[model samples]
Target chain A: MAHDTTIQTAGHDEHHHESPVVFGFWVYLMTDCIIFGTLFATFAVLRNQFNGGPNGHQLFEIGGLALETALLLISSITYGFGMIAAHKNEINKVIVWLGITFLLGLGFVGLEVKEFIGLIHEGAGPDRSAFLSAFFTLVSTHGLHVSFGLLWILTLMVQLAGTKTIPERMMSKLTCLSLFWHFLDIVWICVFTYVYLASMI
Target chain B: MSEHNTTSSGESHGSVSSYIIGFVLAVILTVLSFAIVVTHSLSPSATILTLSLLAIIQVVVHLHYFLHMGGHSEHRWNNICFVFTIGFVSIVIIGTLFVMNNAAVQMMSR
Candidate 1:
């Protein structure tokens, strides 16, 4: 009976000590989804209420949106490679893949910023039309997440400069960052479809 | 160390060729979406519908190949939860938009 109690306690301890990183990241994703979800709902309501200005059909550029999608999609793949390298304990490969991912992500942001500047220059700024407002909010919200993700990756890279791969702290950070990066990708897909594709109509 | 081994083994579960295939498919889908939009082969509504469908497909491709989201494990529950959350959000978005649009239209008419 004493032995049995010891075994049970050990099992409990094991479960308790399991990495909370993934679980915490999952919670974060849920919350982020809700945030974007609210934005999506707002966009849906205001999409057609252009208030006598340009609508999606007039404002959206499908070609540019496609390029943005490619950039994000490729970045996601690079992130996958980073994960693979992480699993293999190839620190250099991990860093390289992450660098690629970062660069691609930066490219995505650059294009989006350019697009926004062009829109503002042409008087299609968010304040010009309700559709533009909704569009900016939905798309920029995703962009903000990507920006945050980039910052997170940079922080992780610095932290990992001298840390071992399997250390609990580093692994936790990596797991959380992975969830964040992937979550952004998922959100972009929705944005691309509903905002860009639908707007083209 | 044990966790590292488990993750490393997970890598072996999927073949490298699969990743390449997924990447190729994604690129093809993206290009196709561009072609449809540029050619103006469809009406506005039709274009929206088709392109959105394609975008959804591309998303699935990324989720499956890149993220490795679906598999039997404790993590499967996480995926289900994620899906449910997204579904709930979609409902809220569509429903709210419908109600608000009707209200706005009524207000404008009056």
Candidate 2:
């Protein structure tokens, strides 16, 4: 009986010591990177195929993009704060920071949706040209990721609300979400640079 | 509070100062990119090159500060996987651009 308990204890120790869960999630995110990379490539190839329609210089508004970048960047930092709070097991603080992050993320998606609507109204719809199609696909794909992230944040908050102390399981889950959020911000940097900034040039 | 603080010392999760520093640097890089384009200070090729460089730097900042993938031992596989993905991603983007641009040029010339 004593031997059995020792073996079981050892198994528990091994479980908590090695964080394959987080590592596995990281690998998943790397796969996401490849997906974004292919989308970017597609955009680059078709960016100039405007089909006698307005080009990027006419379509992209640097001011609006600057605002969107600001929103996303700030949200990334807020999510980092939430992660820090989660590490301390300060559940309330974690929820608060994440709440702020959610709002910022919402603002980002809202702006993106508005921009898409405006573009369509201006006859820059995806069906108008190959350039428009690629542009809408790439940008909207990022926006969709952000929207999914917001949903994830809400789900995590609901989970956290049920616990007074953050468990190891929850912490690992939050870490994965944190990585996802920061990864999206990095991808946005590329999007703004390659899609908007490069277009102006 | 004491119970929570005890476990915090061992974790690799960074401090507030690191996050703040990363945010400031990112903001500066972002503003600089916009300024370069707005002012048209550099030649067209130079502007694009500078914008790309700034973007790359911001990505590194996010990786290190935000994602916590700095050269720590725990991030070994993560870093390896990231570098590996970047290699393939670079190949795909650059290759597609090269082939497509060349084909377009050839076809247009004909």
Candidate 3:
């Protein structure tokens, strides 16, 4: 469904053309951003409402979170590398970099699940207090996105591997995924500072 | 997003140096926020404000470098979407805080 404006502009430019689908993806991403923003606000309001339960300073392990943060941050750039490879139409390099990105993303989700389970085991489950509920909801929502991103990476990899050449449809999806992955990194930056770092200091 | 972005023959490519620069800046920003929090080297309010400011800066850096959010060729929608998102985000966040905080005060005082 190429818009008339898209074709005319794309033809005139001779290079640096973009499909209209990315605009739709941008709209999708903004809605996602709104959801996250609301979640952050919810967390902010409830962060101090421990209700005689353990608070962030007690539950947050800054060291572990920092490591998790590093993994996700690095993974975003690794996915960026995959995007570059995808553009260059290099199947092997794209697979290698995307494989690395998948590992890092998988590692991030693992650490998050481990931390959530650990907290639950210690009687600090979401039901423990308002603060705990907000914390779990916000962080787990992020983890869920990462999990989905992992699936997207796998699907793209399998598709690329079978096709033996990069297709435009797959490339568009890859570009959107690249944007999604990087957007998640930015959100994680906020979580690391506003939630974890603020609670600690 | 990459610092040096080029598209020819209907393919988009980014420079290695661009990715490296964004990565290094992000890492540095993350470490700085951590160090400031762990060390307790400033007043509590100052620390929070400083960390928040740094986070905002890092967001901008990622948008510019990694997301390529600027006015790229044939990408007017990207900029428009960014402005729209920011407006909506500010409203959602600020509105939530204002309403929730007020409700808490009224309920608790009663």
Candidate 4:
């Protein structure tokens, strides 16, 4: 009976600690949602205001966008696997999954930047039209988030080197970073479908 | 449902199969969306509407399988807050675009 009481008390204490981290991560997600919200609104307002320049239908290439979308969406799934590995206390597996995710994210960004350069070569830069301006803003905002997430994952890898699995400090940071990473994936889905696929139509 | 929060520390939890399923669905949706665009079967407005719906579904998949959102937690308020944010943003985007687009058309005609 004494052991049972101690176990119950310990469980309660862990709950008390976990709730704050979960709630804090949720708050961060809300703020990030707001940022994406603003970008979506900006895109909506400027989508058709091309100022006599090439519009979405003329510029977007569905083949290239498909590749970019695949990279980002797959990365999100890889990150989920990383979290699962972390939960199991498999430190090496966690690091490997995260490394894969980071590389996939970098690949997505590389494709996006290359696409932008291709557009410039075709004389369809952001300054050429209001539509291009909105396109660059919405897409680049997501790319910037991916870049930051990569940096955060690198930092966490270093911190996790000496830390035990499910350590409170590391869990908090991972929880937040996980939310951010998944959020970017969600944003990319929107961009791929609306900006790329719809434009091609 | 239990009052005790079961912290499965160092114990593997969450189904791996779900992540794989979500990833597959995402790829299928992307391919289907691109197929529609490449074929150009729909008009611009229709294409935009359809694609946006697909995007929303993809977002839901990522949220559920990847983020593991939506469950009984002490922080139900967080989910409620996120829903409200999405709603508010939708209104702002749609409403502003509608009003501004009309105003612009009117000014151009004048």
The total of clashing pairs for model 3 equals: 1
The candidates, ranked best first by lDDT, are: 2, 3, 4, 1
Order candidates by TM-score, high to low: 3, 2, 4, 1
Could you tell me how far off, in angstroms, the CA of residue B86 lies in candidate 2 after the best superposition? 0.7
List candidate 3 stretches off by more than 4 Å.
A1-16, B8-13, B108-110
lDDT for model 1 comes to 0.72
**Which ranges of candidate 2 are over 4 A from the true structure?**
A1-18, B1-11
When superposed on Cα atoms, how far off is each prediction in RMSD? 7.6, 7.0, 5.4, 5.4
| Candidate 3 accuracy as TM-score | 0.91
Candidate 4 ranges beyond 4 A from true positions: A1-17, A162-166, B1-13
lDDT of 3 by residue, A165-199 (tens): 77677778988998889989999998888888999
Q: Which candidate achieves the best TM-score against the true structure?
A: 3
The most accurate candidate by DockQ is 3
Cα lDDT tens digits, model 3, B20-87, are 78889988988989999889999999999999988998998888778876655456767787788889
Q: After superposition, how far is residue A160 of candidate 1 from its true place, in Å?
A: 1.8
Candidate number of the best lDDT: 2
| Per-model TM-score versus the true fold | 0.84, 0.90, 0.91, 0.87
Alpha-carbon error at B1 in model 1, in Å? Answer: 28
